[model samples]
Target: MEIPAPRRTRIQQEKRELILEAALEVFSTNGFRGSTIDQIAEAAGMSKPNLLYYFRRKEDIHETLMQRLLDTWLAPLRELDDIGDPLTELRSYIRRKLE
Candidate 1:
């Protein structure tokens, strides 16, 4: 049987998002190879140890960010349908992507 992930409290979820946003800024500016956990923690305004409570490694943060971006980028494509008018569907897809 598969183990389910632990559920997070509202504050925990908010902290995770904060970390992700900070990581994005760090990674974009420093690149993944140049970025450090200390940098990300500082950007997030949390201690390195506290950041570790949310993510064990820089790779984990990068992977999570990439996965979220990929999911968002593909969502509009997934909504496209042959049954829908092609022009209208294309316009809708463009709008979603822009947003």
Candidate 2:
């Protein structure tokens, strides 16, 4: 029989975050073409099987990370409001990004 899978979305999200954080650190030093699942798993402090349980493949993780990165990368621009003072809004946007 197959083992039951984890149920909590929170748990899965946490583990996914761990994996992404680790992958980012590893990928920063070694480009995607040079990185591997083993490196990401070791950095994430989880076994290879455990990492795979959350992310099926390195490409999946990379794609997820890239999507999240793009979302955040555009957040400040998304916040721009024509109704707000240009300088003030720009300052607020820069502040948000710095934090």
Candidate 3:
């Protein structure tokens, strides 16, 4: 059996994160129909092929980012429960939003 090599540098990891962040910004601003791999690559300061290496397709990138956003949005709501007072819970929720 063969094993893949791990990424050798923190820079590569950072670059991947940058690419994802840029993709999210571009996709959010332009919507899926209007965004292109070239645009995302430019926004990420990377080549189209490099972007493709991280994400096989534009739809794949969009889906991954959307799922991430949904997870983030749902996390706070999940923290709310029936145990807290309404006004205090609302204030805590507002603070979480600002945070």
Candidate 4:
């Protein structure tokens, strides 16, 4: 049987978000290969061990960020209609993405 994930308290959830944001900033400037857990933890204003308590590895942080980005980035495209005029649909899709 599969075990369920534990529920996080509000603070824990917030800390996780903080780590993800910090990771995103570091990865954006340094690229994933150049970024490190120390950098992300420092950016998040937390210690490396503390950050590790939330995400065990830099790869975990990157994967979470990419997954969130993909969900958000692809949502607008998924909304595009096959029935609408091609030009209008494209314009609407672009507008949704820009917004």
Give the root-mean-square deviation of each candidate in angstroms.
1.6, 5.4, 3.9, 1.8
| lDDT values, one for every candidate | 0.96, 0.94, 0.85, 0.95
Q: Regarding lDDT, does 1 or 4 come out ahead?
A: 1
Over the stretch 3-80, how does candidate 1's per-residue lDDT look in tens digits? 999999999999999999999999999999999999999999999999999999999999999999999899899999
User: C-alpha displacement of 44 in model 2, angstroms?
Assistant: 0.9
Candidate 3: stretches off by over 4 Å: 1-9, 82-91
Q: Estimate candidate 1's RMSD in Å.
A: 1.6
| Best-performing candidate as measured by lDDT | 1
On TM-score, the stronger of 1 and 4 is 1
Ranking by TM-score: 1, 4, 2, 3
Name the weakest run of 10 consecutive residues (lDDT summed) in model 3. 7-16
TM-score, candidate 1, is 0.87
Q: Sorted by lDDT, highest first, which candidate order results?
A: 1, 4, 2, 3
Off by over 4 Å in 4: none
**Model 2 regions more than 4 Å off:** 1-8, 82-99
Candidates in order, TM-scores: namely 0.87, 0.72, 0.68, 0.83
lDDT of 4 by residue, 12-33 (tens): 9999999999999999999999
